[model samples]
Target: MKITKSIAITLGLAGILAFKQDKEVPVKAALQAAQVHLANMAAANTDVTQYPRSTKKDGSIATTSSRDWTSGFYPGSLWYIYDYTKDKQWETLARQWTAGLEQEQFNRATHDLGFMLFCSFGNGYRLTKDPKYKDIIIQGSKSLISRYNAKVGSIRSWDHHTDKWQFPVIIDNMMNLEMLFWATKATGDSVYYNIAKTHALTTLKNHFRKDNSSYHVVDYDTITGQPRLKQTHQGYADESAWARGQAWGLYGYTVAYRETKDKRFLAQAQKIADFFINHKSLPTDKIPYWDFNAPDIPNAPRDASAAAIAASGMLELSQYTGRSGEAYKKIATQILRSLASSAYLAKANTNNNFVLLHSTGHLPGNSEIDVPLNYADYYFIEGLIRFERLNKGLAIVSTGGFLTVN
Candidate 1:
């Protein structure tokens, strides 16, 4: 058999198994494989490093490199470890990663604090019931809310550069609205819920294409509070569908539906999922291109992050709809198996740490295009946990058409 890079990588770290005549393979083995991969990744990030803010086109600090909220995924990655294992060592690492994030809490500007802190500290508090984690999440939520624009009725994004966009709203910002939802539930504050609902409505109306796939960014008229143009900044072109953006739409709408129980959100989630699953451009392993229409596929590398995020959404969908028949569970299992066996990096005691591999950051500068990504690791772990929980016969209650809870 001709072994491709993906197949070779899968065969290398974990041995392949032959199926017996009539018995189905156990899901626990796959979960154990994911756990092994997670353990290896956790061991890899022992060394401490600080990220410095990089320079922008305007000769000012662009995005902060050192513990900025925008650099949220790595710390979020640690939180996954803490959640799955309940290991003190993982907890310790999560604390160390979050200690560095304390500096950004005071900035109170960017919309990514939810991605940075909520996935880490907010999850930490929710899982452990630690007051400190609650405080951290509250502060991060406050910071996220400060970026909301009363004029546009949505959160502002991209403070650094861009002339046509003053209160630009990006599809990625949809993931951050969870902080507002959480605030409303935690503090009994309706304002946060109203704001979050408004943002979701705005995103539903503007950010999505006809096929339910989405643009990376949407320019909104700050004065008139109308959508000016739908565009893509971090994709192949302004009109193209970025794979991660699609993943965001899938996961975000599922989450929104979970929160609101809105059928519209559920419909949107299914639409995005259909677009992703039916795309012929997807790799043989069912992982996706960085951009669906990138114009250089076959040779264009796949984004494992996109696959991981989509897998998480699929598992949630299976639980939401209560139809874990062959087709639904089979695809979910296939994705989990591929990620566990193929993309996972299992080196120990190094700083080049990540779980899911072959993640494409971007293609514009040909930098970090098809490498290990932190968000991929986070979502992959979440998917595994969801699978494990479901396989154990845990009943999932659909919170809205978007989210699932035990």
Candidate 2:
């Protein structure tokens, strides 16, 4: 529960004192800075079909098609900016960027439709109440559920690497469930809700360790409905705890608790949060190395994307705990402040026009090491928005009455 020690050293004596005095999160300045960076990114990346994913080794922006799993994030970040600024310009740009991914509503081949569709269209619909966006979201949910196996009680994650895994389900799939929950909320059908709930329960049963940290991938046998392999495809080793995988578990379970009001999910989320926050490897600034168990400790590349996602998720998790959640909020605030600092935040027209820097995408593959990533920016903005909402006594992201649509 103590965040002041390391955070004090990272942010200097003023920040340590601010933590003691219960100071504001400085969301306005962060948001204002983000707007300028977003504008630079928007101007630089005009091709909607190719969303900015990350920077290449040669210092150029790497772009991916809408078919890429990360395609939704750029548009989703735009929607968040629009929500924060309420400017017609950002809305126009959000719509433009979002429209390119409409074809992905039927992409059932991958288990990432929720990330691909929901993050973009869901936020757009939430902000604008656009009927077209709503329809796309419902269809996208249907597509996402198509990957669900009744026997396995979980959605399949990767279609590739079949030689390695029979039915691979990665921890990142937890992120896509938020859209399914939203779908059932939008419509009165329980099919989406049931699939999502079952998936969460199945993952809850199979994913965590005794210490509450999660494996990156759990390969299930198709016939017996048992885990064939519980290993790490992205971490340092099969037994290593990947930093982003842990973030995904924390965010995923938090959403599960939010959608279902299930206390088990809440308890699981708390345990995961405790594991992440209290882990010995977490740095003084609260940003974690790409893998907690990486052999190169203290020298491993940092994943700002993981830190941003955890910050955003913990902000929401903080809201559910009342006064007991203050510590979670404070830790999340420490992460946000570190991210907003000059060390992480990219200057305008720099970092290939991306907002944040130093995210590790896939270390084992030797790809995207210490580069700017779109999702890091997305979640950093999201964390700022959530903090500002809490400051103003508003519900974070407006669930539209939780279970009821009207």
Index of the highest-TM-score prediction = 2
Q: Report model 2's TM-score to 2 decimal places.
A: 0.92
Task: Residues 308-356, candidate 2: write the lDDT tens digits.
Answer: 9999889889888777688889999899989987789776557876878
Candidate 1 deviant stretches above 4 angstroms? 1-66, 322-329, 343-351, 395-406
TM-score of 1: 0.83
Residue 401 lDDT (model 2): 26
- Each prediction's TM-score against the native? 0.83, 0.92
- The Cα RMSD in angstroms, rounded to one decimal, for candidate 2 relative to the true structure is 6.9
Give the runs in model 2 whose Cα sits over 4 Å from its true position. 1-24, 398-406
**Model 2 lowest lDDT segment of ten:** 397-406
Task: Put down candidate 1 lDDT per residue, 1-406, tens digits, no spaces.
Answer: 1213353345224522321221243234444344444444434334334422222334332233534644656556556656655767667766666666765665676788777777766766666678877776777777777877777888887786667676688888888877778878877878777888788888998888887789888877878988887788889998898999998888788777777888888878778877888787876677788899989787777887888888887777665555533344566667767776634443322214344557777677665665666677677777767777777776431211123452
Error of 2 at 300 (Å): 0.9
